[model samples]
Target: MRLALTFLRINVMNELQYRANFFLQVLESVVALATGLIVLSLIFAQTDALDGWTRPQLLAVLGVFTMVGGVIKFAIEPNMARIMSDIREGTFDYVLTKPVDSQLFVSVRQFRLWQLTDVIVGAAVVVWAVVTSDGSEQGSVTGGGVALGFFVSLFAGSLMIYCVWLILTTGAFWFVRMEMLEELFTGLYRAGQYPVGIYPGWLRAALTFLIPIGFAVTVPSEALTGRLTWSRLALAVGFVVLLMAVTRTVWSWGVRNYSGASA
Candidate 1:
């Protein structure tokens, strides 16, 4: 945690040198949020509910999507790009020689501090949606349990996403030229902006098990909107543990292989 904080502080200072970038980041965040809201409004105009989700519920889902997406852009994507570059350039040896865990070093070495604006905006949207939402359609989630569940699910979802990115980027050890691999994740994540239930069964299954878009966004949204099932929450937690173990094993193998090749 201390090392991560140091990296964050350094990143903040570096970003402070370019003050104008702050406004640019804010503008970009605003544009992205506005675009999402506009599309959502158009969808709701034709139908009162989306896959049985009311506007407020859908908006809550969007907020979770935005917040999680911001976290990816802020840390995972940038660091993953750096790892790819280092692998391609044969400079990853520096990381291998360090005493710290290679995966931890690679994950937090670079940060886009300004991208946190999206997180702020997304959190605000979630609070507003929760406050304004009528409980007519939702189940018995009238108290703070919903909020607690939402946050717990959100944390688990974030960890799952980080694990997924780690697994993907670890492929850089073998496919050094595959810098664009992260783009695949970015494209697939767009599908999570709405509830996964509206999609066909196959697609919904793919989202839940294959790419895990359902766990990342929809599960948390369901928690917030009082629609999350206990079984699904357990499944999400199980995925988190399983993915974390798998990613760690894969990362270790990648590091070992890279070390062998370098030696």
Candidate 2:
């Protein structure tokens, strides 16, 4: 924890040197949020709901999507991209020489401070959605229960995403130029802005099982909107554990295959 905090402090201090980036980040976040709202408005204008999800519920989904995207851009994506690049350039040998756990060290080495704007904005949107939504519409779910479930699921979902990303990035050991995977992941992640149920059965299965955006965005939204069931929550938790185990194994195997710059 101390090592991670020190790295975070360093990143914050370094990024603080360029204050203008903060404004640019805020602008980008606003534009993205505005575009999302416009699309949401058009969807609701045609019908009262989409696949049984009300406007506010869908708003919750959007908020979670934005928040998770912020997290990825802020920390996970930057670090993973750096890892892949370092691997490709054979500079990853330096990382292996460090005393700390390589995975933990790599994970904490990069952080985009300004990217947190989306996280704050998304949280505000989630609050607005929760407040505006009718109690009966939410099945009379209690705030405490929803909060507990939402937070737990959100943590689990984010960790699952991190695991999946690392597992994919580990492929850099053999496929050195895996940068294109980032664009592919982002394109797939956009689908999480809406309920997975609205997609075709095969697409839904792909999202739920293959990419995991369904669990990352939709599951947390379900908890917030009172649509999450205990069984589903358990399934998400179990999947996260499995993903973490798989990621660890993949990372270990990849590290073993790394020949380093000296080699």
- In order, candidate lDDTs are 0.87, 0.88
Q: Candidate 1, after superposition: displacement of residue 55 in Å? A: 0.8
**Compared with the true structure, what per-residue lDDT tens digits does model 2 show for residues 102-165?**
8888888889999999999899889998888864434333467788788888888888888888
TM-score of 2: 0.95
Note the residue pairs that clash in candidate 2: none
Instruction: Determine which window of 10 residues in candidate 2 has minimal summed lDDT.
Output: 134-143
Off by over 4 Å in 1: 136-142, 261-263
Identify the leading candidate in terms of lDDT.
2
State the lDDT at 181 in candidate 1: 81
Let me know the TM-score candidate 1 reaches against the reference structure.
Answer: 0.95
